[model samples]
Target: MEHPLSQFKYCPKCGSKHFNINNEKSKQCADCGFVYYFNPSSATVALILNDKKELLVCRRAKDPAKGTLDLPGGFIDMNETGEEGVAREVLEETGLKVKEAIYQFTLPNIYVYSGFPVHTLDMFFLCQVEETSHISAMDDAADAFFIPLTEIRPEDFGLGSIRQGLVKFLSALK
Candidate 1:
């Protein structure tokens, strides 16, 4: 795996070429004495189940995993809590207003964006929606729908963290 800061050739603080690896997770600028840390971005994943125990799923609309199965969630925006981020993401991607978002487990992920790996800590949540009948694929989701839990294959999920998280979730239900 490439270091998260491997692509950076100059110090962001000083724009100097003297930037060098300070440690496993940071870099230091020899010229300006500036230290930059690469921390995992906070992300969210929603686990929405309908009355029939069917899980809500979406299809990726863009690259990185275009057309592959995904959950409805995304990176937490500035100043947003995990719960708020999950609810907002669900609404944006599936048009479903989250009534509740219960905290669950978390998984570390490496999301490749713009040809660079973005390390992320994905916070999973069990979400309840106000309405399920009006779901429409929106935002980054190309398509969205509910699928029977028994019929879901974790391998079909495009993201590694999602696949791992799904396996853990299913195992917990057993």
Candidate 2:
């Protein structure tokens, strides 16, 4: 619990470690008067299925959870619709465009980012892309490939979160 990123720091008014996370959007120090609110990031991800029913996964190249296999997704820029975000993420992470996308699920997740408390409200969609088109990895990805859903395992994932998402998505299919 003693990490530089815990979001817990001296209130300056009265140094205290008692911080509350239940605040509507801000954490107020129980002692002094320090307010901290996480800036929740909005993200959109695309679950693309090919003709063989294989799902496309990308190996991440960035941090927070680097070197992991994940769905095509990224932060949603201001004023951007979920559709636009997902489409852009897919295009950016993989050199392929989704032809159609259908809403699937939403998840509110929190994780430590660079030792800072951060949260994410992720919107997911099932997408269909060109089946025979050449697949290639682009931004924020080291590589990508279409693999059978059953072949994905936690050990194969570079990040635990993406592995969990894949597991959940696969479970929903069953």
lDDT of each: 0.96, 0.74
lDDT of 1 at 63: 75
Query: What TM-score does candidate 1 get on C-alpha atoms?
Result: 0.97
* lDDT of residue 140 for candidate 2: 88
lDDT over C-alpha atoms for residue 164 of model 1: 98
TM-score against truth, every candidate: 0.97, 0.75
Candidate 1's C-alpha runs over 4 A off are none
Clashes of each: 0, 2
Q: For model 2, how does the per-residue alpha-carbon lDDT over 41-157 read when each residue is reduced to its tens digit?
A: 888778888777888888878776787677788889999988888888888888788788788877876556676645777788898776537777888888888888778675676
For model 2, which pairs clash?
5-115, 27-36
